[model samples]
Target: MTPTPADKPPSQALFSTIAARYDRCNHLFSLGIDRYWRKQLAQTLVLKADDAVLDICCGTGDMALSVLIHTPVHCVWGIDCSETMIQLAQEKRIRRAGRGRLRGKTLRLSVQDAAALAFEPGMFAAVTCAFGLRNIPDRARVLAAVFRVLAPGGQVGICEFSLPRFGLLRSVYWAYLSRVMPMAGRVVIGDAEPLRYLARSIDHWHKTVRLEEELAGAGFVDCHCRLLTGGIVTLTVARKPGPLAAQPFL
Candidate 1:
């Protein structure tokens, strides 16, 4: 139980160590409901052809693939902090191309930190992060980064695990997230540490209202959330307003 400077586990090292088994453990921990969650997120964004989308913390590119499958988006870029995860994503890209699933167009995956995005302003039409925000300690910085890279009126969609809103559901969710998830990680991934971090991070996450307020404060407008599966997870969507010229102060 080592702590980092940010009062969280060293996510970079932890994710690097567990990159190979990350997806497997996700399936086990969520009882495979993660797929449905990702689908809902992709659907909410309403991606279109010729649209540019950025998937931050895009481990193994599942959400990106979901976009490709559901939307006729011209380009999809997936980025993560872990190089190993990027490698796997690239390998999958290659396989997808070989199978004639993706041709002519390019699918890109790279190692990039969300808090310091390496892109020009308004580069993407939409942005997404799935099950990744909690791992980031400086949430506000990342949200600011998201705002900077997004074009005015670009949409942002985020899906994350949350404690259930109902009492009975919260108890069941906690037991599965805390105890069963770690055990499944040990049995399936052969690494229990990352799962422990995943659980602890969610347990200590800022409340939903606080997060919504933070997004609004960071320049996201029309922010709204839909709690899924009895609030075990929440998907929030917001749009960056058109260029903010000087306005009279109240």
Candidate 2:
């Protein structure tokens, strides 16, 4: 059955509740590899100087910050549904600016839903989302919105958690996700439900959707997927067909 927005899980509230400890928990859970994953997604955009970028589901602005730090884009606009997450992202942007690291790049963040992006058509050179797609119920709607906002030749890069493909590693990883992750979440944040929900979401996403095929269905060309860290994470890159479609960064 096709899930509607009403079928969406209560992840936004859960994320807001853990906003303060979100980064710490992610680092702990991923062994600090989350940063590397974001970097990879950022670079996959192949952003050029003076290009404007949009990051949807831009949790805590880490993905936007990665683009600002790694690419020469003139500005990045980030949107998220969680107000707390946007506030934290704003705080991080301010901190990065104070450290004189932004190099005059701009980051504009707001609390906005990814399914209904409030922007003009073809407004950005690239779009990115990291660890955000799994929680969205109407992914086709969001991808359509993403496709509409991207300029012709623009690209989209997504980073998501996936079950490992190898048998032994898959078993070990599932154990860590299903058991250790929840226990650690309880110890660190006094909450186990969110981590449990995370495991379930990853499982559901893996079993139900093929993101690369979804991207193609949304009128994107040159779709490609790369498994990072032994398929524990997948990076999907695709392009809106145009002159730049030939120059993908996958």
Per-prediction TM-score, please? 0.89, 0.94
Worst 10 residues of 2 by lDDT: 1-10
lDDT string, candidate 2, 1-250, tens digits:
2333333466678889999999999999999999999998888777787888999999899999888888877689999999999999998888788355577789999999999999999998899999999888788999999999999999898999999999999999999998999999999999997888888878878888888889988999888888899999999989998877336566
Alpha-carbon runs more than 4 Å astray in model 2: 1-8, 98-100
Cα error, candidate 2, residue 47 (Å): 1.3
Q: Hey, what RMSD does candidate 2 come out at? A: 2.9
Candidate 1 global TM-score: 0.89
Clashing pairs for model 1 are none
Deviation of model 1 at 222, angstroms: 0.3
- For model 1, how does the per-residue alpha-carbon lDDT over 132-153 read when each residue is reduced to its tens digit? 8877768899999999998888
Poorly placed runs, candidate 1 (over 4 Å): 1-9, 98-105, 206-209, 243-250
Q: Pick the candidate with the highest TM-score.
A: 2
Residue 55's lDDT in candidate 1? 95
